[model samples]
Target: MGCCSDFLQRAKPYVAMISLQFGYAGMNIISKVSLNHGMSHYVLVVYRHAFATLSIAPFALYFERNVWPRITFSIFVQIFVLGLLGPVIDQNFYYAGLKFTSPTFSCAMSNILPAMTFVMAVICRMEKVDLKKIRCQAKVVGTLVTVAGAMLMTLYKGPIMEMVWTKHVQPHRSSVPETTDSSDKDWLKGSIFLVIATLAWAALFVLQAVTLKQYSAQLSLTTLICFMGTLQAIAVTLVMEHKPSVWKIGWDMNLLAAAYAGIVTSSIAYYVQGLVMQSRGPVFASAFSPLMMIIVAIMDSFILAEKIYLGGVLGAVLIVVGLYSVLWGKYKENKDIKESKVMALPLAITCSEGNGHNMDLENEDRRERKPMA
Candidate 1:
């Protein structure tokens, strides 16, 4: 019983993160279906955030009401930008890209998010680099490889690798004359849009990190951000979508898309991922994103009868490899930083103990260093 309990404890984060990815993958596929059904992405964004706000607001009000951070102008400004970057720009462009491209392709393209975040962090002076360091070199190379894979996927479609299932399904698909030539152009356009969306997402992460320093109430902050995003999305949707028909819903896929994305991806995901990250760290939580892409690919092929291209497969492989390399580098860098802090702790304590204990401290330091060496 003890052994089983220990194993379950160790496996908790793995289970949570994998489950989170599946939730994300489902959102991608469902959102794709809704988009194909002619649902406006703008209105979808508005409704999604509205539902997210409704779901999260109760928790924030109940659990965090007493401890909520005092909202200052700086914090409000940060939250405003967070809403714009995430709900307004990132989500709008992502849905637009999904409309123009296959769910599998969009998911694959989104795998570059970590690499984009790294670049943005460096540019924003949040991350440091030393070319001489192997870990730093790995991060740089990984970013380049991820970019190259993205470019390859964008520029080269190659031939579709026929699947056993898609064989019968392709013939059943509409024989109506479809503009294949325009699809290539749209694919390129969608790739650009997805890239922009990913960049905005990365920027949101960077800014969120900065905002968290001032606002420490996680649930309340999330609720406020979602509330702000809902308002922003409403304004944007009003400007972009004039037809009231776009917002109408009658228990359809669009409603599912909005509800599932808002509750599952927005609210539940944040809560679950926070729990996992608390136990295992953010890197562990992030490492499972590639699983979402893989799950989306399989689901797309099976459900949507989407064609899997050879170039896309190869590019996805490269991106996955690069993602691991970058993650490994980050892991090593963080480990070293922690070890350095641990090493410095003894010296800090020793100095604070005054000169009388200096000799004893030196002896204890030698003892600690022996095992470390």
Candidate 2:
């Protein structure tokens, strides 16, 4: 029983990461459907974050009321940027990309995030890279390989596979399958949007890491982020969407998208990720992202009856390989660093003892030499 408890404790992080990825995959699919059903991405952003703020703010206030840190001007600015990058830019562009492309494609592009975050961290000096170390070398090479995979997937789309379901029932599809010219144009455009989205996501990860160091209340921080995101989305919606009717939703997929994205993906995910980042670093939390890509691929293909291409298969494999390579390198580097630190303590103690002994012998020799005095 004790061993089982210990095992569960050890496996908790892995389980949480997998669960979070699955949640994100669901969000992508639901959002894609809602968009296809005539839901506007801009409006979706406003509703999603607004609901997120409402859902999480109470808990944050209740749990962190006593311990919440003061919100200084710098921290407020950082939080505002966080909101802009995450809820506004990243989500809006990503939703637009999904409207133009498939869920699988966008999710696959998201796999490039670990590499992006690694580069950004190194640039920010949050992560140190020792060029001579094999681990660091692998990380760099793996990042390049991941980027190459994403590019190949975006630029080259081979013939679509003749899946069994592609010819059968098309449930909840807004339009017939895309034409060659139209699909190509949209794919290119969506790929561009997704690339920017991924960059923003990476930047958010780095920023969140930095912000957490200053304000350690994870739940409260997430609530603040959600609040800021809601306000930003509101500002954007007011500027772009003029019609009041556009915001109306009675009982449709738009409501589904808003509820699911708000409650599960944004509010819960933000808080959970904050907790995870507190325990593990940002990269560790981001490493689980590839799982969502794979999940989205399956869900899109089988459920959505979306066409899968040969290039996609090859690219997904390469991205997965790169993701693992980076993870392995990071794991090895962390292990080595911990071991080195542990070994350093005993060596330090031994050196201290040796120096103390040498000092005692030198004092005795001096006393003997001055015996006549």
Number of backbone clashes in candidate 1: 0
Candidate 1, TM-score vs. the true structure? Answer: 0.83
In the range 262-355, model 2's lDDT, one tens digit per residue, is 9899999887777776666677778778778777866777776666777877777877787777777867876787899999999999999999
| Cα lDDT, all candidates | 0.79, 0.84
Q: How many backbone clashes can be found in candidate 2?
A: 0
Q: Candidate 1 residues 49-131, lDDT tens each? A: 88988998898889888898889999999999988998889999999988888776787788777666776678878778899
Cα TM-score per model: 0.83, 0.86
> Which runs in model 1 stand beyond 4 Å of their true positions?
1-18, 158-185, 270-290, 358-373
Clashing pairs in 2: none
Worst 10 residues of 2 by lDDT: 169-178
lDDT of 1 at 232: 95
> CA lDDT of 373 in candidate 1?
38
Alpha-carbon lDDT of model 1:
0.79
